[model samples]
Target: MHGFAARDDVVRSGAPEDDDTVLRILVVEDDEGDAVLVREHLQDGGLPHETVWVRTVDDALSHLAASDCVLLDLGLPDAMGLGALQRVLAAGAPPVVVLTGLSDTDAGVEAVAAGAQDYLVKGDVGPDLLARAVRYAVQRRRLEDTGRALYQSLVRAAETTRLERALLPTPAVRDPRLEVRVGYRAGRDGLLGGDFYDVVERPDGTVLVMVGDVCGHGPDEAALGATLRTAWRTLVLAGIGADEILELLERVLAAERARPEIFTTVSMLAVHPDRRTADLYLAGHPVPLRLGPPSALLPAGQRGRALGIPVGGGWPAERLELGDRWRLLFYTDGLLEATVGDGTQRLGKAGLLEVADRTLRGDVETDGAVRPDEDPVVGMLLSGVRARHGGDLVDDAAVVLVGWGG
Candidate 1:
């Protein structure tokens, strides 16, 4: 190697002594004479630059790993012709500019097809062309990197939306004796949170429904929520009762949860269609309010702790008869956590019931059908909470209203 020292390393560009931004180039060439010739041309071109020469394919790869632009001589002693070009391109960001001997412009063209940004005929090119080529390759690589980053961002955003939609529950029981509705609002605009719900109708006509909130916001929380909802649905379909399903779900919560601090508050309801009786299982969650002949919060008995963070023993499922045309409002804490005033006091369960009473009793139209007391029940809950909070709630909110149309 003529004056050309072989070093496996990256070349970092420094501002020229004259204060101009200089382009950095990694030259992959085995011949010292050729490397010097290329550098002379680039320096002579009045363009500021520093070239780091690597002689072998392995050395070039190491340099590629560290650097961004490559001025690659197609024919090298260790890796010859287009093979050298391909290896460099595959390594990373540096767009390649092929260096070719006079008779080998064809090879240079072929190298470009294999992903080289441009080619230079060695003996025929001057300093201006050499400098311009390296600068152009750098600009090209920058654009390509920007585009790749943007595309990945778009893909990630779409996945988050899909994951969110998958985790959300759709009402399953359309009993003439029940009116079922659901509401969900993500606290952060364009962000996914850990709220989830699912309603499944078993072969025996028992409706198994659940609503839960994993303890955070973002993709990880959303993903775990989706996993938990899916597991719950599968367990219900497998004919598991509420207690057994909760135990199994706790196992999943332990295994699939991304963080140890993460936990879930869930409520599962099993409605027996024939007898019109519903079994309620609480797992450290907000209780469901039974809006019966007189709309009110059905008592949420003291029971199980949050899943994964077990307090002690298991929960005994409670059974209740579904009154004719009853509406069950199941919600996440975000609904009640909304502030009732500028003070530290929260809406709490009792405060929420008060709002529900006022709104449900007032003429509110929901689903376009306004019974004397049948206002937009779900809307009132969300809007009323926000009005009291001074704005939207600080956390993600979700709601499910199961109305049995007697």
Candidate 2:
């Protein structure tokens, strides 16, 4: 019944001086004599380590979790050969250095392929060899862990990009007289944010435009925003009335929301192909800016509460006389919430109109002959906001511009 020498009595030969960083080793060997020899070899080696000895695979599993490395014996009392090694590895054991007999060295090699980090024959291993094997195994395991983490990060980034593309889709309008332009900027939050917008020209010669913001910023909210936008597009395409569309959207938001507290602020506009009238609906959203003969914010009387709010209500659609020429701008609250200068004062709705007017004053010629590739007024407005903020906006921003008979 050989046993480990007392820590005070064990002579430290060439072993490195103990420091704060000590490598912990779990020795899973059935024979007490073999375990004593292995501990003596590591103590005499120049590496600082603390060893925990266990006689069976069951006992070893308990100590495996906190150990930095494992010195596992293939021939345990209850387990034998690679079966023992496979069980320890499957239990999420740390880096393993399999201990093998002279005849079973081939089995040790197989264990290495089966996920053990390294292997050493009992009779051939010296103090230095044992320490070196343990050190190398720990380092290799850390490198593999790091590589796995980086690969997972790349996969997440690719998925985020795909979701963002779906959230902000291209306008589905073919009318030459009607111009639709959109600009989007994701906030510092992440690749995907809660902002979304969509434009669609119906079969009956009517254009449906919407801009919305879910309550929070993250993957869940971004995904919810995309779902709502798709639902809106489907409803409009199916010839749902403007009033009925918002009611259905409210039900969808309530059902799909991750939490009851989450809500969405949205602005919707329906423009007739005759270019004589437009209907506006505001649900706890900002008033749209109309660049008429005189630039002003369009009045939608008595704005309704945002969707998903506990309070029940209906949003009334206000119809406006579009006259002959009009350019309308719809945006999320992030545009008006941008901070100005070094203070907390927001740019607000008035500031946004001024920015649009200033940009339009210089680009009158380009505005006369609009091309799909040319910069739209919404892009210019976003640029002004970014310049004022000194960089990206604090929250996700989305804007859609619709022009008819311009």
Candidate 3:
């Protein structure tokens, strides 16, 4: 190749009319005659090619970095064959095409695998072959970059999954009288949607449990839900009542929200271990169902709107007895958002209760008989909704069942 000369022959911009014109190529061949021949062929084949020859690997690395394409000769004084190609690829050079002699076919194959776009045999290739190879190599590298970006996105999603699990709160309870079971599923699959739950055992021996759903589904909403759950637990530990806790949550939701439209629905359950009495508070959240001998849907009494709405509004609270061995189920709205038909009608609270009752009594007719010993009440309720929709719930669904087994 010709000695290093600071010339402006290569690396020119595209024409004004052809804004997306052909790319400029830099030929890094140590042999001066071979480099001249390659440039002649590229020019004859109607390629926008430029030759910048460097006898040593150091000069080649610097020159290739600015070039759109490279034609590298495997045999060089400083680096030979695969070693030189390795240095070029390691230096983060653009797409390169190896110039190999007829005797070094194996070396050429290795160079291509090591990261060269393509390889051509010396003393045999024509102008069209040279031009086509360069164009195709550049296109292939572009596609490879795209694939790498998509893989990175999947990696980020996997990392988010780990973060979501870590954020799930473990119930804090010392009283052996209460057995709390909590579960959550995001409605928009593959993302951490805004749904959260927590259980905290305060210093006063009272168990505080909560489940909430933020208005929108996105990272911002999920993050807000996480923040609210942590704050609620902290306030409960600080000795706040169910009613006051919900009110404070509303204030926090109002202050910390990213947008004015963002709101949250929450249900708080506080149980006294000694008395077996519980207080329920709801702010636009689904009323938890009681599963026991009475097995009925308890009212949450959400007199006020959801959090972040009409900021600082308060809601009414209700007191109920667990009796003995009663189970409470808390869930988000994704479970009830299913449409009964093509119309605007939805399987709302009443319809959900009817399904639960029928499932418990084994009166809801289906193709198969009720499985023996299976929790048919909850199972049937979920199944009924899925059946209506013809498959899994279209929206994300989450459930937390707290059983006060005496």
Candidate topping TM-score? 2
Candidate 3 ranges beyond 4 A from true positions: 1-143, 292-295, 300-302, 342-344, 357-384
Deviation from native of the Cα of residue 178 in model 3, angstroms: 2.1
Question: Tens-digit lDDT track for model 1 on 156-254?
Answer: 878877887678856656455556667776773547688899887877778877899998777788899999998998898888876699899989999
Clashing pairs in 3: 1-30, 1-31, 1-32, 187-396
Instruction: Mark the regions of model 1 whose C-alpha exceeds 4 Å error after superposition.
Output: 1-68, 74-91, 104-110, 126-143, 150-158, 187-189, 202-205, 216-220, 251-262, 274-277, 290-297, 336-380, 383-395
- Please provide, for model 2 over 1-406, each residue's C-alpha lDDT reduced to its tens digit, 9 standing for 90 to 100: 3455432222222334466557888888877788889888887776788778877888888778888999999998879999999889989999999999999989998999999999999999998999899999999999999999999999998887777767788899989888788988777664678889999989888888999999988889999999999999999999998878888998999999999999999999888778789889899999999974357999878588899888877788889898888899899988888888785789898777777777677532121322355356666667777766666778888888888875
lDDT values, one for every candidate = 0.76, 0.83, 0.73
RMSD, model 3, all Cα superposed?
9.4
**Candidate 2 has which clashing residue pairs, if any?**
none
Measured on C-alpha atoms, candidate 1 has an lDDT of 0.76
TM-score of each: 0.70, 0.79, 0.62
| Model 3 TM | 0.62
For candidate 3, the per-residue lDDT at 28 reads 72
